[model samples]
Target: MAGLISKVFKAKWLLLGIALVLLLVWILRPFLDVFVYGIFVYYITRPIKQWLSRYIKNEGILVSVSLLMLALPLIILIAYTLLVGMSQLMAVVNSYGLTAALPSGPLTNMTTSFSQLHSNLTSGNFTLESVTDITRQDWYKTISGYSGNLPLLQAIAFSTGSTIVDIAFKLFIIFLVGFYMLKEDAHMQRWFAGTFPKLMDEHNRLLPRYASAVDADLQKLFFGNLLSIVFFAIIAAVVFEGLSIFAPVPSLQIPSPILLGILCGVSALIPIVGMWLVAGPLFLYLLISSLIAGTLFTHFGYFLFMVLAIFVFVLTIPSFVIQPFMARGQVHSGLLMFAYVLGPLVFGISGLFLGAIVLVLVTHYFGIVVPEMAAEGQESHDFDL
Candidate 1:
């Protein structure tokens, strides 16, 4: 009877623990959204905080100033870069006699290529005459359709307003979370450790070790790789802009150096030839624009640029692949699985950074908590030795 009662009591506690976890998840769902975004901002800004703490004579003042200096430029640059891209797109559209000329540039060029492939698959091959006829028909239909839907201006206004509101809310949450995370990061780590001391055994210590390894991996991967990418992107954009100015192609659209720089920089964060993801579209844009302008024969400069782009990509192959893996190896002994998680299911681009951190924390806790718990139960038997 005593043994039977103990088994029943253990089962009850197990069920109760599960129930409490479910309840907590339910309660925290709303706040978790904000916290998730907060975590991204925190990770990105953590290095800045560290730099301030290390170099600046005044810690608090330096952190405050660093944040202001960091934030102001980021906000302005993102806004201005996006604005220029939009402006260029709109100008390209307007330049074509089509009233709303569909802008096809380095970015949209990829979409156009995919669409053309889709058309080829669906619509079959066409002779030159048929192609010309189809193009004319499509152009006519597009213009007429757009004219008929001119009242979409109101819809555009509504959509723009909603987008602005949403962006404002997201930015507000990010900064709010970032500030607190930076301010109380040390306290938070302490809090994380303190809650489980009684529950921890030898095995439980493994959890903290694993978590620390994961955190260290992420800090190096996200920050170091990000800086490297940004530096390379600036170099690429300067090279591309210079190429375009002198390239023999009658290129009407010059890629904004800053915009391309930022785009390439961001793309560099993604693993394995992501810079090519940016470059491929850029080259396609040049190709299409060259075709439309009827200067394909004279565009020797673009050929040279195309060659240069390929060379740069080849040169950076080591940096993009081998370097990050080497960096990761130093921090995480078993993180190959963690690196693969980002490419498939990005919550957003930031998911790469956030997902790695969460996985680390979970594994850390499991490794530490489980081993410690097992060791506790083993103590009686082992003590007999």
Candidate 2:
């Protein structure tokens, strides 16, 4: 009885110590994220660091050179893409006369048909003048609502600034971690191997295999996705220009090649619907413009179908076909369906990385524990019999 009591008291103290440590970690969680994100960045750039190190024969010089080399290309590409998108947006706004309330040009064709159909059915005159008044009133209301959101806009700006600072700090941490990880790569491996006395040989043997698996899977998913986005953007641009569907719509005057390409590329990351995310507002623009021209009733149905089809193809196809295959291939930690779903829910956007690590550790721990439990249960049953 005394021995059992002593063991229980020891366990209680151990649990208390662990709880204190966890509490400290939780409090420091936000700062830790900056370090954690840096680790992921290190993982992504490790190969480049190695290759550069070989050429320079100095780890420090190699890391510095590789970072500069990577940064220049990334900055140039992002700047060019953003400039192209913004210039196209400004051109579209300018071409529409900025504040002109009436729908004009090829867009007038749909309005003309709608007025005739409405007059035929209602036995009342449906004039373009009345339609125009209603539309201008609605636009005024929308503008007023946006004007009321000035305070919200300021809050958003402040939040954005803080977020940028956090990201910058994290990126710096990532570079530091990457440099040291590259410099002392052998020391890290040796430390890991020496820590596990019982399974030192097996653990050392499998460490490289595990690391390689993670590296291969993550690189394939990330790089393949980057390529896919660029490809899809180019395709969207070509399709928009060739179709000229937006040519008739005043809401979209941007050169179809540049504007549509960028929208398709960036929005493609949104889980379910990619380019279709923008299609709804665009369709509404056409609808409102036609209404003001007194011809919305006639060609509305046809216009609706065309917009729907474009959105469905742009948004749905990639998500259903591409995403699942990549996810299954990369996340091979034998996580069950529940963990797979809930992992992201608990982890935020960073959940994909953290969740995979947690899942792998949990699985390994259980793999050891469950068999021992089973074996003990069987032995007890035999003794009882």
Candidate 3:
């Protein structure tokens, strides 16, 4: 009768816990992005928080100093770099007369010109050289003329303003939540441990060990990935800059070396495909340009060769050589790769971290927690016998 009553009491608490969890999830659904980002920020700044804690006893002061000294500056630097890279990329697009082709006026004119060119080609009267000349003169002029319109500028300004506001609001919420989380990290952990039922004594005892394993894996994944990004970005920029300076064909130079490098770095974060995201588009652009101009086939060939070389040296080599060393046995390479790839697809950008966390927790429960519980049960059975 006592055992039956205890089981019933536990069931009642379990149902209450489930209901509370559902309520909390519903309430937090709107701010999920902010909370997810806050967790990421907390993980990234955890080491700083620990280090600062040694010198400062007050958690509030330590978190504030860490945020100001580390997080704020990092955010500002990233924002500045992005703005500069975008400006440089826009300048390159403008220089190439690409943006001019985007407006309706220029697109309509290009369509008319293309129809005439197609008709001439079908008649066999227009040679490739004549077609090239027409493209150089008519296409260039039409694209260049479209750039002076006022509506395009106004549209761009409005879009930029709205994007900035959205980004700022998100950042504010992330930092706010992250600051509090960091300040109360220990208390949160204690509360979480206490929430588990007494029936889960073994699990409660093993919780710290499980948490430590998760933290180690997360640290390795985050820091190793960060290093990989920086390494690829710098290598890509240097390789492209070298090609611009030394390549035999000046016309085949990478248009925006810095911007391309930044993009390559961002692409490097994507698992499996990696830097190919940037290199593939560049290859296509050069191929099309060479075919259209007809005179730069050799230049395009050399440019393509250089791009492949950069991919091999900067991207492929490091994935094998540097990443293993950085990972330090904290997490399986295949699993981390899967988490990086599938996380964003399922959960948006925050999925990257969340997926890894879920994987780690599941692995820990099965590998450590379950086995330990079974061994304890066996011991208890032996003692009863």
Candidate 4:
């Protein structure tokens, strides 16, 4: 009877503890992005902290220098890139007269083209070959006169301003939270480990190990991503600049090579889409412009094709070669791909990190921890019997 009462009391306390944890998670839900960003900053700068610790020995000073060396430069670079890219984008819009290109002009041209085709068909002069030729010529003519409307430009400008403000705020929060996390990393770890019930020896041992595994995975994901971004950015800039300088015609040039290159690097983070998000629009523009200007089949067209081929190759290498090599024994490529793609869909931008954390925890528990716990449980059960 006494044993039963004791068991009931313990179960009630366990339930209460779980409730408290759930409550804490609820409270922290809104700031999940901040914490996730902080963790990323923590892992990325951890090596620097350790290296500097050898000489400095003061944790605060070590963390401060590491943050300044890594985080500050990174933040500044990102800000500068964003500002330059926006200016470049606006320039491209103005140069292409995108702000003046209305659907009405294109639609009217398309309607005229179709009317002519219909007249030819009804006049008993239509053949498949003629129809195709006429259609192609009409499209070229229509695209040549393209100019974006004012309303669209106004919308784009408004959205761009709002997006810039939002990104700036988020970045500020990320850096602010990250600074403290880097400084008190040791204390944070101790606090986390100490959160579990002291009586549960298994949990106390397993929790830290699990955390270490997660940390290692986060390091691979973030550092690999950063390296890929830098590599792709450099490659893209060189390729675009080379084409711009040597292309046979000025019409074949890529507008704002730096902006396009940075966008290409940013696109590397998205799984299957990759750099095509930047390359696709650029290629389409070049193709249309070349066709309209009767530059197709010329040296300019050849150079444009070369640019496309090179960009495709660059995009392919990361997915097929670099990523596989980087993730070789750490995490499965398929799982990482899923996390990269689905994370943003489910958890917004921060999902990339959050999804990875969940993946690591789930995989660790099922692949390693669960089995060990089960084996121990079986042994204990046999001993009791």
Worst 10 residues of 4 by lDDT: 102-111
Q: What is the lDDT of candidate 4?
A: 0.64
Ranking by lDDT: 3, 4, 1, 2
| lDDT, model 3 | 0.65
C-alpha lDDT of all candidate models, in order:
0.55, 0.52, 0.65, 0.64
* RMSD (CA, Å), each prediction: 11.9, 14.7, 11.9, 14.2
Which residue segments of model 2 deviate by more than 4 Å?
1-24, 71-154, 157-168, 202-212, 223-385
lDDT of 4 by residue, 74-129 (tens): 64664444444444544565567874542232222222233333333445533466
- Number of the predicted model whose TM-score against the real structure is largest: 4
Candidate 1 lDDT (Cα, whole model)?
0.55
The C-alpha TM-scores of every prediction are: 0.53, 0.45, 0.56, 0.57
Measured on C-alpha atoms, candidate 2 has an lDDT of 0.52
Candidate 2 lDDT tens digits, 110-130: 222322333334453344575
Error of 4 at 265 (Å): 5.7
